[model samples]
Target: MRGHLPNAARIIDGFHVVKHANEAVDKASKAEAGENPPLKRTKYLWPGNESNLTDPRPEVRRDPAKRRSKTARACGMRERLQDIHADSANRTEAEAGSKALRSWMMHSRPEPMKALAGQFRRHRQDILAYFDRPYTNAILEGLNSIIQHAKTRSRGFRNMDHSGTMIYLTCGELGLNTVTA
Candidate 1:
């Protein structure tokens, strides 16, 4: 991509990165739940809501079981990484915070999270570039979704031109004011 667009700013969408981190946490949690019955059915509790969590009590803090659980640890690390995005005021700060998170993940017990950390390390610049550019392909994705919906409605267009026309009619901003006779 850089080779084709030499001047374009390469950025990894923060949304997808966080989503991948959540997936890693989910995988860890599922595996942990198989061994620890208490962790079962708590899948939804971590992936999305973990970031909103407040500090744990000092007593829970002292519990080795809670601290040693791979899922718990992964969720904690994922939450911490999300905090970097929420709290960092500038690119430098975001980068620093992400580096710290990456280091933490590298040493963490969860294999999935360790792999995710490696991905973050490999795409460090592209991921951190998001702090500077703050751009995502959301609009393009929305348009693609709309087009897909149009295609599904048609089932199968007879020709390429028909498909293109359908997409244009569905997605184009055509101002069709009523014409009186």
Candidate 2:
């Protein structure tokens, strides 16, 4: 589409991009956990917020050594990336954050994170565009999920129109009293 619409701005959803990084962190955590006995039942450590590391939960607070492992480093990277996304108030900040993320990814020990960094580098421009608009397809994705659930609960829609109506009723957020009036 970029070839056909030269003037159009391309944007990548920040949430989606960060999900890849999170996946890498999870992978690293699983690998590390498998090798270490203490970390065996602590799979929840990696995906948790950085603050959760100090939480009162025995699983989290009990293991200081777990926080020093390679998985922790990967989780740290994930947390930093999340901070970058949250801190970017404008395009310039976003650009700087993206650069920092790229640098961190390049040095990251996990192969998956390195590959994710390469992907971000390739689409850097589109990813940066997200700072300008701050819009994401998350809402659409949620609606799609709801529609799928609706379809599954009812077995299937008889046709396209039925499916469309189901989706509209589920996702349109309509006021029935007003519509009836």
Q: Residue 131 of model 1: what lDDT? A: 86
For candidate 2, the per-residue lDDT at 126 reads: 90
Q: Which candidate is the best by TM-score?
A: 1
Q: Residue 87 of candidate 2: its Cα lDDT?
A: 83
Estimate, for each residue in 66-165, the C-alpha lDDT of model 1 and write its tens digit.
5578887898888788788778878999988988898889898799999999999899899888888889999999998999998887767678877776
Q: How many collisions per candidate?
A: 0, 0
Worst 10 residues of 1 by lDDT: 172-181
Residues 108-164 of candidate 2: C-alpha lDDT, one tens digit per residue? 776767877898899888988888877887777888889887676655657877666
RMSD of each: 4.1, 3.6
**Regions of model 2 farther than 4 Å from truth:** 1-7, 52-54, 58-64, 153-163, 172-181
List the candidates' TM-scores in order: 0.82, 0.77
Predicted structure 2: clash tally: 0
The CA root-mean-square deviation of candidate 1, after full C-alpha superposition on the true structure, stands at 4.1
Candidate 2 lDDT for residue 121: 90
